[model samples]
Target: MEVKRMTDREIVFRLLRYEQANLRNYQNYLAYTKNKDLSAYIARTIPQIEGNIKSLNVLSRKLCGG
Candidate 1:
């Protein structure tokens, strides 16, 4: 088994992708969950995930010079 190290840019891109997927999953869960408490928790968590995605996008742009 071999372990590969990722560059900073690659790591940022991976983080951005992961956050995007997580945001989508959270939204799906929020829509389908019937429990009010869980829904509220998901709602609260969504903003933080969105913020992370936004920040990662900014970082990506900075790295790529777009």
Candidate 2:
């Protein structure tokens, strides 16, 4: 069997997609949650996820020679 190698740009793109999906899921969960503490936690986490995506995008651009 042959192994396939991944590039830094490809990896960052996949990570960006994953982080975006998680952010969406967290937003939906926050909307449905009734517990104040949990909702607060989820809301706060959403920004962190966004920050991760932002950082990944910057990395991806650099990897792509943009």
Candidate 3:
């Protein structure tokens, strides 16, 4: 089996997709969790994920020319 390398754009796309997926999961968990502590934890974690997504989105836009 041979490994394939990804270009910078491909890597950025994958990272953005993964971060979006995590954001969705955290949103769902925060919305549906019955335990208050768990919900709070999810809420706390979500902002970091959101910040990463925002940064990646900016990078993607920069790569794509605004």
Candidate 4:
């Protein structure tokens, strides 16, 4: 089997897309969970997830020469 290498732009775009999806999932979990501890944990994680998305967006912009 062979793997294809991705360009920096491609990599950043894929990562940004994936992180955005994960952030949405986390937001949904936070909205639906009833347990207090679980809610707290998810709330804490949401900021980290948002940070990741922000970082990825920056990288994507840089890669695209924006």
Candidate 5:
């Protein structure tokens, strides 16, 4: 099998997808979490996750000429 390489744009798109999934999963978990401390921690990370997704989206768009 030949090895395949990913371009910077492709890599950024992949990371963007992963971060989107992470945000969805984290939000879902946060909904079910009952503990105050755990919920607070998860809530805090949500903003960071959102930021990552936002940044990744911007990077992906820039690389793709969007």
Candidate 6:
């Protein structure tokens, strides 16, 4: 199989999609879990996830010239 190059916009889109999926997974973990310690661990990681999203947004805007 041949690999194709992605444009900047496509890269940004994929990055944003990945970030969204991670956040969604964390949300689901929080929703269905009964373990307090695990929930606390997830809560602690929320800030890191938010930071990643912010960084990706900045990179996307820079790439798109928005």
User: All predictions: root-mean-square deviation over Cα?
Assistant: 1.5, 0.8, 1.5, 1.2, 1.0, 1.6
For model 1, the run of ten residues with the poorest summed lDDT: 56-65
Clashes of each: 0, 0, 0, 0, 0, 0
Off by over 4 Å in 6: none
Model 4 residue 39 CA deviation (Å) reads 0.4
Top candidate on lDDT is 1
Q: Candidate 4 has which clashing residue pairs, if any? A: none
Off by over 4 Å in 1: 1-3
Clashes of 5: 0
Q: Candidate 5: where are CA atoms >4 Å away?
A: none
lDDT of each: 0.95, 0.93, 0.92, 0.90, 0.92, 0.90
Q: Give per-residue lDDT, candidate 4, residue 60.
A: 78
lDDT of 3 by residue, 1-66 (tens): 999988777888899999999999999888888999998899899999999999999998888878
lDDT of 2 by residue, 42-63 (tens): 9889999999999998998899
Residue range 1-66, candidate 5, lDDT tens digits: 998999998898889889999999999999999999999999999999999998998887788788
For each candidate in turn, the TM-score is: 0.89, 0.93, 0.84, 0.89, 0.91, 0.82
Q: Who wins the TM-score comparison? A: 2
Cα deviation of 15, candidate 3, in Å: 0.6
| C-alpha RMSD between model 3 and the true structure | 1.5
Model 2 TM-score is 0.93
Clashes of 6: 0
What does candidate 5 score in Cα RMSD to the true structure?
1.0
At residue 34, give the lDDT of candidate 6. 99
